[model samples]
Target: MLRYQWEDAVRFWNSKKGEDSERVGISSRQKQKFTHTAGSRSFASVAEAEEVKSGQKVGRLQLFEITHRKKDGSPMTSEAGEIMEKLKDKKAEYEATASTDSSVNLENIDNRIITEVLGPERYSRVRFQGSGVTLTQYFGSGSQQYMPSGSQAKAEVQRLRDQMAQMQANTVE
Candidate 1:
C-alpha cells in the first residue's frame, strides 16, 4: 500500500522474491524500483516518503508519506507525546486554509487502520500517526469503554470516516 498523509491511496506491486529480500536489506535494484514508482506518483514532489511494515505485527515494507506545508518549520520532533499533540487539531479551519495555499498541501487523510487493523484498543494506546513526519497529526484519546475493539471500535471508525469525508467535501477550492 502507498499511504499519503495516512490515507491509503495507491497500491504497491512487488515480486514475492523482492519482498523477501527486503527483510534483510533493500537491493540496489529494489531501491531503483521504489524510487521510480514513488517518483512517478502525484504526491511525489512534496510528500516525504518512507517504507513502513504492514502492521506492528507485520513485516512487509510499504510506502507511506507525509506532506509538509511549511518550509520554514524544522523537521518534526521524534518524541511520542509531542507527536500526538502536534496532530491534535490539524483539521481546524484556519490551519487547513493556511496549509492549502502553500506549495505543498498538508492533508491528514482518514486512516482505517486505527480501527480495522489496530482496533480501538491498540489505537488508543498508540501515540504515533502516519509515517516519516517528525510529528503525528492525531492523538490517541485513550479508551473510555472497557472493550473498544468491539462494536464501539467500528462505530468510531465509521464516524471518523464520515467526518473526514464531510471535511474533504467542504474544502475550499
Candidate 2:
C-alpha cells in the first residue's frame, strides 16, 4: 500500500505542467524512511532517528521529547521528562527482548509502543479507523472483480452456509 502511495505521489508530481514541468524528484531513501515510520509507528532504529533529527531545521529531539514543554525551553515539569524517560527505557527493553528472542514479533513491539503512546481509548479508535479504511478499500475495488453488488454478496454467503449445512447433515447420516 505504501508503495502504491509512493507511486501515485511520483506520478502526480511528474504530471505537472507549465513552470512545474521540471518534474519533482523524491529519493527512494525518503520513501523507505516514510514506509518504516508509517508501518512501525516509529523509526527503524535509533540511528535512523538521529539521521532524521540531523535533517530537521526545527523540532530537533521532538521524537523523544514529550510535547508539554514551555515556550521558555524548559519542561512543564520534571514528571513529564521522567515519564518520557521511562517510556524510552521501556522501548529499549522491548527492542532488546525482540533481538534476543527469535519468537518475538517486531510488529507486536510496534503495536505495543503505539498503544502506549496513544493510550487505550485513542489506540482503539485508530485501530477501528484503520480497519474501516481497509474494508472500504477492499470492498470498493474487490467487489468490482467478484460479487457485483451487495445483494449478490449476501446471496453468495447464504449459499455457502446452506452448502455447509447440507454437508454436515450428510456426514451425520
How far in Å is the alpha carbon of 117 misplaced in model 1? 8.2
- TM-score, every prediction: 0.19, 0.31
lDDT over C-alpha atoms for residue 138 of model 2:
28
Which number leads on lDDT? 2
The lDDT, on a scale of 0 to 1, for candidate 1 is 0.35
Give the top-scoring candidate (TM-score): 2
CA lDDT, candidate 1, residue 85: 35
Q: Which residue pairs in model 1 clash with each other?
A: 76-134, 87-137
| Cα lDDT computed for each candidate against the true fold | 0.35, 0.47
**What is the C-alpha lDDT profile of model 2 across 94-149, one tens digit per residue?**
67755765444454343355446544433223332222334234234442432224
Q: Model 1, 1-173: lDDT tens per residue?
A: 33573352222225566566666475555443112122334442322333232323211111121322123443233332233333344334324543543422222222322233323424233312333322122333432322334554465466569879999989954
